[model samples]
Target chain A: MSESEYAIEVENLNIYYGNNHVIKSINLKIPQKTVFAIMGPSGCGKSTMLRSFNRLLDLNKNVRVNGSVHLFGRDIYTGDMDSVEVRREVGMVFQYPNPFPHLSIYNNIALGLKMNKLVKSDKELDERIEWALKKAGLWEEVKHRLNDYPSGLSGGQRQRLVIARVIAMKPKVIMMDEPTANIDPVGSKKIEDLIFELKKDYTIVLVTHNPAQAARVSDYVAFIYLGELVEAGETGKIFTAPESKLTEKYLTGKLV
Target chain B: MYQFDMRRIKEYSFLGVISLLSFFMIFPLFHIIFTVFVDGIGTLVSTGPVFITGTLDDGGIGPAILGTLILSFFASLIGIPIAFAVGVYAYEYPYSVIGKATTALLEITQEFPTILVGLFVTQILVLPMGTYSAIAGAFALAIILMPYVAVYTKEAMSQIPFSFREAAFSLGVTKVKTVFLIIAPIAKRGILTGLLISVAKVAGETAPLLFTAGGLYQTYPDSLTQPVGAIPLLIYTLVQSPSPADHAMAWGASLVLLLIFLAAFIPLRLSIKEVRM
Candidate 1:
């Protein structure tokens, strides 16, 4: 595929923590405005790959990355591209709901807007917050209590609030690192639906352990194993006719 | 069943012994507080409120009270900002050699004698300035408190889950904003409690002020350069005087100091409760 056709392009990527090799020789092309799901068992380097997209791994002291991650043709790892700007363009949601506990729900969304200077006026800020919350499908449940702390929300609501926080930034791509893993089944279902809804507007890189979830919500599926990308293809093809024996074994529940 | 009964007896006896030891350990603390309160209250009742507002020569602790407040305020003003900066730096680079060095330095400073701090300040500020000023005294107290505040700030910043910082950074906020706006606010209670405790600790210290402040000023200090009287210094000096009136004044000053501590500590503990909830 042409580079312009992809929202994110990775070429010969490697990541390390001190002497430990975490991700090895990864290359991926994630198309714009599509849901790309990365599935693997625990310790498979799926989340590491997602974090490297925005350079979130830069926060770790001993981390080392080789090669490049190109976001819309710009090499993000190059010295000229600021990590902060890269993060603004490529946002993330963690496995656990981690809203700012000290801030009210409205402030939690407004903080990014104010910090990024995304809005010119208070009315514009409020409008943007409302739009983001609505996009995350949390506006109706929390509309009356915008000033309440995030700790008051249910686990599902907190996750949605975190999603709203990310959406408020209006990034080109959104990374979910097992977004629903810590939530209840109902919350997980809502998140899946939200992910499906979000694919029309944003490119999504989802990391999940559940093969069924990856099959259900993703347009493209990539399976990773022991710090390597085993296979990646269209979701239907990968699920129905996997190219690798390990992928087939994992899908058939024989080698989970 | 017999083994179970024996286990129960052993546990209860152990609990009883722990309780007795705990009471023994705490006995002196309560006795000192009780004695101070009884003696100080008697002195206050006999001397009246004027004892609090009067000058040292007149058997009043007013100047001393005002002086302690001023000294603690200035010390906190000097110490807190430096402590926070060091704390944030240490927290942000916890694994760096500099961070480890700072941790080691803070531990040593915490254990270093406060009298040495006073002597050090006396050499730096007192001798050169030609007068034992409030500034020197406050500097002494600040050095004594800095390590405590820094340790507290670092621990408070550390207590915040790394995920919160990740969330802020992922939003594209600068590191400064993440630390000051997000992390500091979340760690507010712990930081404030540390500040209060440090203030209380410095307020009660007499040796440092004696060396730097040159205690026993007759009036409230008008400037940082003026010699100032502090409560602990007043109590220390009055208890050694030959006059019975001086002894009574010492009791009153001690009471006032105790009240000051209660005022800081009670609210601090309450705030801790609020934060936990």
Candidate 2:
């Protein structure tokens, strides 16, 4: 894709939680239709920087941000821009699979569409839910029991349901923050496979501590250290021919 | 090894003694329920017609029953909503000075004695409405119930997971709807339980009503401005009287009051058990 097709751009980003500087000055770019993985040790600001893309950090009462993040060539943090509209275009999936305990599988997927008023009729809603579920690879497994509560689903199934919920909104960028942390190895692999399948249609940004997991899925990788961007490039080059000593140590599991 | 066996035996005996103390602690409730049945049965039989009919001169508790029902019902009707809003705001959106002040006031009010509540309401709502008015009685009961409902609702709302809130927020739902639709629905059962307990507590309180609502009488108020007689007030009057028949009506009235409270509580308790913990 050309430079004009860039999906997201971050310049001179700094994030603070009260007095603590959690994310330092950093810059990066993610193009359309690609999966970008952010890897780092615990508390290195990978998650903070990921959340800053859509201003999810604004949820924290202590958080303050100074810098600019752009989505599709538009500044996201500007006064005239609505945070709700930004989130609508850039959807997020949390660490744990949260499918809204009180709602059914079908209702959970339909919730986002309903919020946007994207569907006007019952038949349209039904088809939208089916399409999203199929995209997330959960449609066949849960098709027969659409009305059942989401809490009854297995861990893998719940994660897919969450993905389905987000993808149904037709967000241009889908961000996952350690989405497989709570599930088993088998379930993690399934989600990894699903993420690869998802990048064909939407830009994906994921934060992970596991270099191997990042290698298996991401088209590009960015290594963050103490809130600073250590290195970022094509996934193969970053892993096989890393220029920074810190990146080499982190990739070899010698320093995390 | 010998010392270990002796220690084990000592612990067993200590457990047995503590278990016996628990029975002693609970015995008073049994004594009260048992005594009411034995003491009130004869009164119920002889005055059975008057008891249900509530027609005997200077006797019967119809006015008191009517007063207690109306007063406590109105109290809960007013108090439950206030409690829910205060609880949700205090726990969920507690960034304001007003919310902080309300939470602190509620905590202090919960520990205040019922008679003090009577005094406060007498000065605030009761004196304004006039003593013996049904409105004053309702206000008195509401004052007693508010603290309980607020404290319990806050506790229940706090127990809800932050994940639920984050999930709702991430969905692009506004914070207000996220609170009411997602958080409040999950906390409803606990709120209902608190309201029921508050109802029972207000139903049985005699001290608060004494000053705000005047003694038992046959006259029924046509409006909130008029004097009202509640069951507790009637029981107090009959217990003070010289006539044996009047005293018997007191016990019967006490029994009826106990049953009324239990009837309100049983379903609330059972249904609350079904809510997700």
Candidate 3:
């Protein structure tokens, strides 16, 4: 693949928590402006791989990363690359809705813009907040009460609020670690729709345990089991006619 | 069925005994408050509000009330920031050696006798300045209250989920910004309650002020370097005097002190209606 075609390229990536190797040496490439899904069982190191894209793993004291993860053709783990800047460029949404309770819905989105000094005027800030909220499909529901605290919102609204917060930063890539795991089915469908819509302008990396979700939202799918990649291909092909026996078993629900 | 009936009877008797014992333990506390209110209110009624501004000889505790307020205000000023800093550091670096040491030191300080703190303050500040100044008393009170503030702050800050910190970090927020804007506001109620309780605890402390504040000021204190009077000190000294008028003043002072404690405690309790964690 050409250099410009990939949003993220991992080379011989390995992660260790103290003496335990959690993510074995792996090589993968995620295309630009597409929904790339990493599907795996619990504790399969899929979340760790997603976190590595933004260097969030650096926060863990005992974890060590070996090899390189390049974002848009730049090695993010290099000595001169600031982790803060990398995080700003690559956003992440957690498995649970974690809108800051101390801030209101408007401020939750406004905070990132203000913190990064992205807006020059109040008008611009308001516009951007509205834009992000609309993109996350939360603007209509929250338009009347932007000043209300996040605790007042339902679980799904709070999750969408979190997504709005990330979108407000205008990051190059958005990573979701089971963003729909904590919401109801209706909320999950809304998020899936948002993910599909987001892929038009942003590269999205989704980590999920549900193979059906990956098949529904992702363009490309990768299956990881026991810290190793079993298959990587088109989402439909991986689900319908997987090339590997492990991927076939996992998709068929016989792999426990 | 007979055995079940016997167990039920035994359980009811045990509960009855426990309730009686609980009431017995709490009876003295209520009795003390009742006696204080009766005696103090009687004295205040007879003496009039002039008793507040009147000197000890004239049966007024105005100077002592002023002194107590000053001491607590200054002590909070000195103690709160240090305690907050220590608490934040301890919570953020919980497993670090410095964090462990700070926790251990604060635990030890909480157990240290207040009188010893007074003696230590006297030796350090009183001897050096060649006078028992109000600043010395404030310093001693601050020391005595520091552990409470630190422990409460640590509890509050730690109660904030670790994921919140990660969320802020992922947004490119600096650690200092995360602490001030996100963590601190969430923990505000906890910190404020701790501060008020610390102030109340130090306000009633008499032994520490005896050696450090010198416990006698004919007029309102004008400077931090001058000796100051506090309600606890006034009550301690006046109650021991032989004059019946002095005894009445002591009762009035005790009433004021109790009121101050209530003033601090009621607001603290109301501020935290719903516990976050």
Over the stretch A189-225, how does candidate 1's per-residue lDDT look in tens digits?
9999999999999999999999999999999999999
Please report, in order, the local distance difference test score of every candidate based on alpha carbons. 0.90, 0.83, 0.89
Tell me the tens digit of each residue's lDDT in model 2 across B80-181: 788777887887656678878888999898877888877877788766655557777788788778888888888777777876776666667777877777
Error of 1 at A254 (Å): 2.9
Every model's DockQ: 0.65, 0.45, 0.58
Top model number, TM-score:
1
Q: Which candidate number has the best DockQ?
A: 1
Q: Which is better, 1 or 3, measured by lDDT? A: 1
DockQ of 1: 0.65
The best candidate in terms of lDDT: 1
Sort the predicted structures by lDDT, highest score first: 1, 3, 2
Model 3, span B166-259: residue lDDT tens: 8898999888899999887888888778778778899989988989999764777788998999999999998899989889878988988888
For candidate 2, write residues A1-256 as lDDT tens digits: 2334778999899999999999888999998899999999998999888888877777788899998988888888987368778888888898888887766789888877887788999999999899999999999999999999876788988998999999988889999999999988888888999999999999999999889989999999999999899999999999899999999999888994
Model 1 per-residue lDDT tens digits across residues B102-160: 99899899889889999999899999999888899999999999999999889988998
